[model samples]
Target: GTYPLYDITASPLTSGTHKFDGPEKNNPYRVLGIDEKQNYARFRFSGERNKRKLNVEFLGIKGEKLGEWSISENDLKTPKQ
Candidate 1:
C-alpha cells in the first residue's frame, strides 16, 4: 500500500522591500510528479513568485492517503524539473 514519492522545488524569490508579499494562502497545488519510492507526491504553486511544496502520503495500495507530511519552504533547495 504505497502512493508515490516525489519532490517539490521552487525558484528563489525576488528581492523586495517587504517582510512578505502577502499571506501564504493554503492554496491547493496539483500533483506534478511522483518519486521512485512511491510514498511521496510533488506539487507546484503559481503565485507572484514561484513556489513548491512536497506532500508525503502513506497510501493503501489503491492510492489513498492515510498519513502525510507537508514540506516547508526551506526544504527546497533547487528549482523543480
Candidate 2:
C-alpha cells in the first residue's frame, strides 16, 4: 500500500484545512483542520478497502522526529468523545 506525500516544511504554522488524494485514485484523505494553539489536528480517511497501517510522526522544527505512533483500523472506527 502507498500513502500520499504531504510536505508542510515551508508552510506557516497556522490552523488550516487540507485535502489530498489517497494512494488509490478516487480515494481522498481530508484534513479537517489543524489547531496550532491547541496542538491538535483532525483528519478523515475515505478508503474503506485500505488495510494499510497508519503511522503518525511528530517532527520538530529541525526535522528531528519527536515521537511516532501507529493507528490501527479498529482505532479509527472508535467514536470521538
Candidate 3:
C-alpha cells in the first residue's frame, strides 16, 4: 500500500527532526482516522498519544521516508467533531 509523506518536525506538534529508523517494509503507523474537508489522512505513531492527529497528504509513495515534514497543531485540529 501507498501512503502520503509528511514532516512532523516543522509544525507546532513537534520541535525536532523525526525519522523512521526502522525497516521501511514495516507499517508501524496505524490509520487512526481521516478528514474529508481538509483532504488529510490521520495516522497514530507507535507509543504516542492516540488523540494526537498527524494530518498529511499523498505526496507520492515509496518504500522509504519521503522527506522531512512537520504538521502544526492548527493543521491537525478540526473546527468541530
Q: Against the hidden reference, what TM-scores do the models get?
A: 0.28, 0.33, 0.19
Model 2: per-residue Cα lDDT over 1-81, one tens digit each: 344354322233353534434553243552322223223222333435755456555444455654444555655453555
Q: Residues 6-54, candidate 1, lDDT per residue (tens digit)?
A: 4443222232222212332322453322222234232434334435554
Error of 1 at 28 (Å): 30
- Write down the lDDT of every candidate, Cα atoms only: 0.39, 0.42, 0.35
Task: Note the residue pairs that clash in candidate 1.
Answer: 1-61, 4-38, 4-39, 4-40, 5-35, 5-39, 5-40
Q: How many clashing residue pairs, candidate 3?
A: 5
Between candidates 1 and 3, which one is better according to TM-score?
Answer: 1
What TM-score does model 2 achieve against the real structure? Answer: 0.33
Better of 2 and 3 by lDDT: 2
**Any idea what lDDT model 2 has?**
0.42
lDDT string for model 3 (1-81, tens) is 333454332222223333433453254662322212122223434334544444443221232323323354444544555
Q: Model 1 TM-score?
A: 0.28
- When sorted by TM-score, best at the front, the candidate numbers are 2, 1, 3
The superposed Cα distance between candidate 2 and the true structure at residue 29, in angstroms, equals 25
Best by lDDT: 2
Candidate 2: give the clashing pairs: none
Winner by TM-score: 2
